[model samples]
Target: MPTLYLLKTFSDSTFSLDVLIGEDDMTEHVDVVVAGGGPVGLMLAVELRLAGVAVTVLERRTDIDPTIKAGSLNSPTIQALYRRGMLPELEAARDENMRQFAAFAAQRSGGGGPAIPRFAGHFGGVMLDRDTIDQDDPVLVEQAHLGTLGLVSQQQFESMLERRARDLGVDVRRGVTLTGFHDTGDGVTVDTDSGTVTAGWLVGCDGGRSLVRKQAGFDFPGTAPEITAYQAMATLRGTEALEVGWHVTDTGVYAYGPHPGRILVAEFDGAPRDRTEPVTPAELQAAVRRVTGVDVGVDAITSATRFTDNARQATEYRKGRVLLAGDAAHVHSPFGGQGLNLGVGDAVNLGWKLAATVRGWAPDGLLDTYTAERHPVGEWVLDWTRAQIAIMRPDPHARAIRAVVADLASRGDGATYLATRISGVWQRYDLPGEHPLVGRSAPDLAFADGSRLADHLHDGRALLVDLRDDAGLRRSADGYADRLTVLTATADDTDLRALLVRPDGYVAWAATDAADTGPDKYLGLWLGAPVGD
Candidate 1:
């Protein structure tokens, strides 16, 4: 029998309990143990708890770090949050941030001038023209009300997620770090610094340097880093040395910012020798001068960090009882602001499916669909970042291609393409369906009561939209009531007779006429056989 250790701290004292592995009576159990209580982990925890699954999140940090990471939310991410009843809060937060930014910009411009343009988004350093996007496109039209872009700090976003997780009664344990874990053929015995937890599933949302991914032996393969980038908040002696906004210079690419002291510089001088080393003022000044070809002196610094274009992704998101999400599963350049949105998407997609599996009602191969649906998205993000890096290279060929891309980006179709990818609205899983909207994110269909389809999904259940209020369709869906919600609402689009939407807000089945395919097969395929079957 193996001896497992559990540590407990009482005030100033620490103690341990050594129990034999077979002694199940002494062990703590949970449905899932999520390592790393970042936004992704907390989001997953909330999703699990919403479905009544017992979840325990282990976070190394005692508190949320107020770091400026991802600064915007894409369209699909916005839609996902909206489905969870977070749209109002999201808008409030974005508005507050925008106000602060506006004040800052005003003060910088002497408090009296034409207002700066609101940021749409960017691909590489090329600015996307929002005015040029094709709003008539179905994809863009669906996302219009949701707003294709939302500006919010990652710290604020994580805080919101943490609050939601706690509200959902998720057992979030702070100051606990997952050191290692082993699959015991049934459940995962998670070893954290604080104690041991026996959970049916273990998920790693532990960022790029993930111990779970390495220890669980998940194969992560992709391109290596080519450039070392630095984002810092520091006082500069010569403020006029660099201009605000992104600049692709002969040496490398650099971006001064909307914020007074914020600066970001990227050099194609290979990866940093030691990314772990603390960035010093002297180092930052040198990099700034190198990239901008100007003598700028970094006097004082508040915070600084190094990043690379080192893109890598786990071929599989799961191995037995262990799984990975967010940066743990895939990492790439942060140029397009895709990381957070992608991770949030992963959490939403995996959440209900995992919850169903835990509750013992999931259809065959339900959990397997998580990777099948998400891995392609991750692959595309990796390639997307790589493409940006190609355009950012300082060589002559790269500059020529950059010009061409910039020109294309100025056009309606090109801008729409870029916006669609950046906003993540273009994401559509290849599900078994002929309808164009089948695998796409469901539109926010309106009802007679004025409540949108998103309002019906707040409880975290698959939805059966009965457009005709068909008594027969309602009767047919009665058997699967436990796993889904059947809403008898009038559709705004006359062509959409009825549709079955998954818990993640993707259309699973649709019908344009009475003769069209019914929801029975898709419901069975997704929600499993109805009760008493």
Candidate 2:
């Protein structure tokens, strides 16, 4: 066992502590060491810290990446943050980003047409008409108020998460990269460019090209890329006739400004020879011209990156003590902005379970459930992006399929289907329960005391929400009171009689009457049996 030494420091009225792994060994120790400081890693750090777990985040970049990525947060991610009491901050960030975009548009277009049309999202350049959506759809009605998407840049979201992580005393070390790690039977010994760290566990959130994932020897198998795509912000000439939204041309597809000089073009011509090569203005200009058949001149460019439809996922998320999350666990096309949302979901789902394991109260195979629940979701995302790529292919059969898909998406039912999937309100884990609400995200029900369900979940503990105030139900949950919060409140909107919510906000069990079976069985399955029982 590694010996831990404690050191305390106080500065700026904020408190933080440092743990050293003995002077003789000169190794640092933490409950968890997360590679990558992006939104996924930071969110996981915040979640773990809320459970009082010591976490250290290793990031190679000293500052947030400013490149344009994942422009919106889906429903699940927004609700996850809302449950953690960060909804207000997220909304503020969205509003600020909107304001900045409006200012940029005004300065660039000199107050022309609307910056961008209102829409839920798109599939293969086919827009999901927001106006055609069925507001009363069963899967979506409960979350209608939160809207389909939260418009915030990846940079803004990461900044917010980083701030929360710091405020919660997470050791976010920038300018440090994970060189390698070894998971001994007891714990993981992580080697970084800076130094070695002994941690209870290590998670790789280090994007698609994850060094941790590669070093851990996880098998990553999937399809090869068929198209090369380019996204850039540049100074351009012409484009007088280019449309503002997505367009599927004969050669490929291209989407012009919602932001000035910001464009994305995809060509069916095979993947780039070298994706690592920095995209030049002329290169992007040529691609744009080929896709749109417009003589657009790219004078200057900034923030350009190459991508493909390559999709791959780890056969297993965890191998011994080293695990993977976010892009490190799965890689797919970035269409429909699902990457960030998928990663955020992974963090929320894993944080509590991993924390439980580290704290020594996790039920048998509790940590194993992380991959079981999230791998399917990741697989779904990969297939979803692959479907989009299929529809966007520049072939006669693909165009025919695209037309049918577009028509379907133009109707109420199809729009609702796309909207639910895009917003992630349709996500449900396959937990063991027969009730309709079981294994689904707990509805944000409003209580008689003016508190919503999310308000009670801010502390990152399992919640036992009792609508009927049954004494038997209360007694049944008494054993796990230390790790559970019981809220007795009347909710008018939901027909649910009672709900046992996991720390990740998924319903573990539901009861229609006080006479029904007690929650002890399900609670034990998830939170483990009562100590000394």
Candidate 3:
């Protein structure tokens, strides 16, 4: 057996941890250790700190990347950040004219009949122009701004998050990578580039190629796509029309819009290139000209990358003491820009749960629910992206089918359904039965105390909104006072009287009528017990 060693820190803050290691041959133990320091990892660290959990983040990169890979933030993700008081900074950086365009696509059917063009009406998608909009939106906006999504370069966003995590007292270490890990019964022994650290739980928030996931012996199951996408940012000269045109042709699909210095243009359905081959500026310029029907001069090339629309998800998100989030858990095509948003949501969901478990305020089963809940969501995302990718195929029959679907989508019901799905406004949990509170995100309602439902969740505590006549519910929860908040309101309050909220802002229990049940029975279940008969 390896010898055990303990590294003690002087700090006694709730977010601080004592590191354990195998000295020379010593083995040690700790509560939780996270791998990767990207946005997902940093967000998880900040969130854990906020929840009073001790966490350490290990990052391989010495510095943050300056390129803006993922640009759009979705509505649900914005709401999640708002609940934590982190949305304003992001909203302030949004573009003013960055709005979604709704349109219908019509294509003639290949059959030897009259042009059977199908029309799909407006589907909501955002035009993310970050640099131009950063000034007006600033990083701090009001709660009302939470209703919309914002845009920021990946590098800039990560920088801000790093600062925030440090400010929140999260122990972030760079130039450290997870080499391997061993799951001991009591905790996990993690081997890093610097040294070994032990923790009660290990979370993998690393990217698609996660060492932690691999080390944990988890399997990622999914299909790889045939066509690959090539993307690059460049300073190119384009006519006013060409600069604004979102073009598609027989060769490939291309889009051009104003970026910081030049036009940001991208091409999908391009042939794959080997990683060893250098993608030159001339090659990208030629491809752009071929697809756009415009000869644009490439002044400078910023960055270029190639990725396939492979849709795959981990078979499981959790393996014993090790959990996965972000790209570590799932990876799909970037068609909907859902990658980063989904990962951030995972961080938000798991962060509080991990914190609660570490603090002993939550049962172990609550930790298990993270994978059960998020894995299905990942599967759904992969399916959605696959459907989008299939439509992009250039085959005549596929185009004919797409035209019909587009036409149907243009109609009232089809349009509404497509719009809601694309806008990501229609996602709901699959609750077991028809309970009013089931499957719905807890709404941010106004309270008599001048606080909103989101205000209670901001501190990472489950809130029991009491509408009944009893004031005794508050007295009963006195023992769990620090972990629970009881809000009393009359039926006239309408909004606040209708729902009980979980820390993640989900409806734990709700009633259409204010007098449905006293706070005692509801509180018991919301606090992890079934209501007594």
Question: Which tens-of-lDDT digit does each residue in 1-533 have in candidate 3?
Answer: 76766666535656455544445543334567889999899988887887777778999889995443776666567666667777567765554313211110111112221221222112211222222222232122222335444555566568778988898777788988788988886789898767778898999998888888888888998996665555667666653335342334565555443343233333454436674465577876777677666777777778766666667798888888889999999988776567887888789779878887787666547777788777877888888877766665667765676667667554545554554454454556654333555656666666566666676677777777766644554565555565677777653435444455667766666666545554455455445442232
Model number with the top TM-score: 2
- Preferred candidate (TM-score higher): 2 or 3: 2
On a 0 to 100 scale, what is the lDDT of residue 202 in model 2? 94
Task: Rank the models by TM-score, top first.
Answer: 2, 1, 3
- List, residue by residue over 293-388, the lDDT tens digit for candidate 1: 988899988878889999999999999999899999999989878999899999999999999999888999999999999999999999999999
RMSD of 3: 8.0
The per-model lDDT (C-alpha) reads: 0.85, 0.87, 0.65
Which window of ten consecutive residues has the lowest lDDT sum in model 1? 9-18
Better of 2 and 3 by lDDT: 2
Inter-residue clash pairs, candidate 1:
none
List, in order, the clash count of every candidate structure: 0, 0, 24
Better of 1 and 3 by TM-score: 1
lDDT for position 80 in model 1: 80
TM-scores of the models, in the given order? Answer: 0.93, 0.94, 0.82
